[model samples]
Target: MAASGAVEPGAAAATAAPSPAPAQAPAPEHLFRPISAEDEEQQPTEIESLCMNCYRNGTTRLLLTKVPFFREIIVSSFSCEHCGWNNTEIHSAGRIQDQGVRYALTVRTQEDMNREVVKTDSATTSIPELDFEIPAFTQKGALTTVEGLISRAISGLEQDQPTRRANEEAVAERIDEFIVRLKELKRVASPFTLIIDDPSGNSFVENPHAPQKDHALVITHYNRTVQQEEMLGLQAEAPEEKPEEEDLRNEVLQFNTNCPECNAPAQTNMKLVQIPHFKEVIIMATNCDCCGHRTNEVKSGGAVEPLGTRITFHITHPSDLTRDVLKVTKNPFTLGDSSNPGQMEKLREFSQKLDQILEGNVKAHFIMNDPAGNSYLQNVYAPEDDPEMKVEHYKRTFDQNEELGLNDMKTEGYETGLAPQR
Candidate 1:
């Protein structure tokens, strides 16, 4: 193959051989030969090709080069002289690596953003500080810099809608602000981390703090997740797909447990239910056939929602009981008398009190605090400006954060004149 080079060698002239059987040498496969030298400078070779966009004749230049902490790479560039269009691609000259690779670099300055990165199609890029991630499926592999990656993400951010599902537009605006901050990092020294995780092991980031100590960079090896392996077609066998019914069935073994209300031995039933958009939940219940008493509740599937939610309703009249109310809980509760003789009396009494509140004899407030956005309450009678009854929805609070297991942040103490010695 011809390479992008300054000098083109001419065809060798055949010299007449005097020997009876002339010694022959095979022709070279490449148009431009690679030469070894102390400086190790190689020439680029140019070849003619069709324009990818316009389909017109163009010239493609190929150059072989080495990068800092990476093997040889082929730089292939195309320029259509007729259409004034051009593009470039980089390919590794080395074999596929064995293990998945993760490259992380702390970008502290504008110069740090300029460091080169070779990303493959199987790579996912992320910036934890910005809460931004570019999934492998959504991005194309490219030889770019940290700044280039951030710029591409910014472009995608601008395409989000001005209005979206409740709270989505606000989120997009926040992302826009974050992208602007990233752009400002190009002119300032704000520190951030750039990470590239590739399952195919075809991606690389310039490492300046390695054996050569060219820059501050860290490289790590990791095993790919099942999903990642499947995405990269590295799975040796396809995973079995369980039937929907099988997933819905509760496989828990029945156990004898005492009822919290009656302190009587009861059988407990537990199973997992997959909730759409919300998450999986474990529905558990216990019933005392003797007392006709039953209790049920739900537990979350172990994922935290992005924000907390609060719901409140006021019961002012008997008509409010007729209004539709949706209460989706793992545990199902009822406000009624029980036929079982062993049923707990406190639960029966509470049921009666709830009925009294619904009858308007005792005005009460119904409130539900859920961070997972899994519960709902409807207010069909209230108008937009209703004064007597109102529905309030607000963001999650610090206490909610604590409940969701995300409130572990610790800040440094402010120094004062207080003595430190005991």
Candidate 2:
């Protein structure tokens, strides 16, 4: 055996330390080479760099540009000759915001989908009508149009869930159908809602009706929950458990109610929840243990306001049908069971005419009369100069208020809220 500290004469060469390789100069900041005006103008400053994938030298181009509505951004494009790898990325110079924003619009026409949108990585998108949603963490933001956003979503699903499509033909077909419908929405053949909820507030939807308050776009700012803040690396305190969500064993109220469908006693569960902007609403739900019957209803617990209001909107395009129109009225303004027969007949005629407007068969007016002043027609923002669109607000008359039971009733010598006649 060889001595522990001894090396053979021929082994000296094999054990020698190799010389350190010379360091390579850092690649130029810009991919193209910059040329002076005297030599050749508009020459690109090309920079040779190693391919990120194959670790070989590659050519890259970096351009700094200020895009309209997007501020300044660095657009970097690179291509590798070794492995044929090409990549492009855009970096925004804008500062990241602490609070998030949400932009929602009803896409009803081809023009609506063409509006430019800027989405950041820290944004979540969803189309509730299609039952599709994408989380923020999974997205790398892009400045694209509404149609581009849908295309990106379809491409991602196809790439990420290859096995799912191969194994389940039915599921794959369903996804294909959904993709077709998504494309149709871009062509104005179908209407759908596009919602972008960004916790980073870096997403934007171009105002279709600019320089005016009336537009179909809505911008809402929401507070992030503790869990959401933590996910976004924001400083947040540990949230305390709410009493309602705590274990039922420690609760005092009886949740088991009766099933309305099956008439089963104590077979239902009820809960009252307060929605944002809207007041308390009771959700009564029950599943029958004997018959498997289920039933549920949502009822508002808030009182109706006294004032009455009227709203009107013009329908010029098929997309206008998708606008949310809410009519809130008291018993007198509404055609209910207590309404006179003639009033109900007139309401029926009105409803038929309104249906015609929604069908785009007529460029008629959409008038909503609410005696309670608690109704809204969201995103009816057509400019006054728009020939095809208009919005009008009307105040309720005293007689209308009286019919709605919102006016004071007078007796022989007394009025409502006054002392009775002696």
How does each model score on lDDT? 0.58, 0.57
lDDT of 2 by residue, 1-422 (tens): 11121111121221111221221222222322222233243243366776656677778665543343334444455677777766544444444454678888888878788887777666778888877777665655466789888777666555534665779878767666766776666677767788999876667787644323436777777777777777767677566555654343243334554443223444545566655443555666766665476766665545555455566777787787775443222222233232345545555666666666767888867677776655545543332244543334456688776655555754344545666655
How well does each candidate superpose onto the true structure, as a TM-score? 0.41, 0.44
RMSD per model, one decimal: 29.3, 25.3
Per-residue lDDT of candidate 1, residues 1-422 (tens digit): 11111010110111111111211222122322222343234566677877656677778777755554364556666677897766655565443455789888888877778777887656778877766677674544457788877776665555443543245867666656765776876664667777888887879886433323545676778667777767866545566565465654647636575554333457998787776434577788888755456888777745655655566777788876764433212111111121122223444555567667766899887777777556645546433444544444457778777654576743334476454443
Please state the error at residue 298 of candidate 1 in Å: 52
As a whole number from 0 to 100, the lDDT of residue 332 in candidate 2 is 28
Highest TM-score among the candidates is held by which one?
A: 2
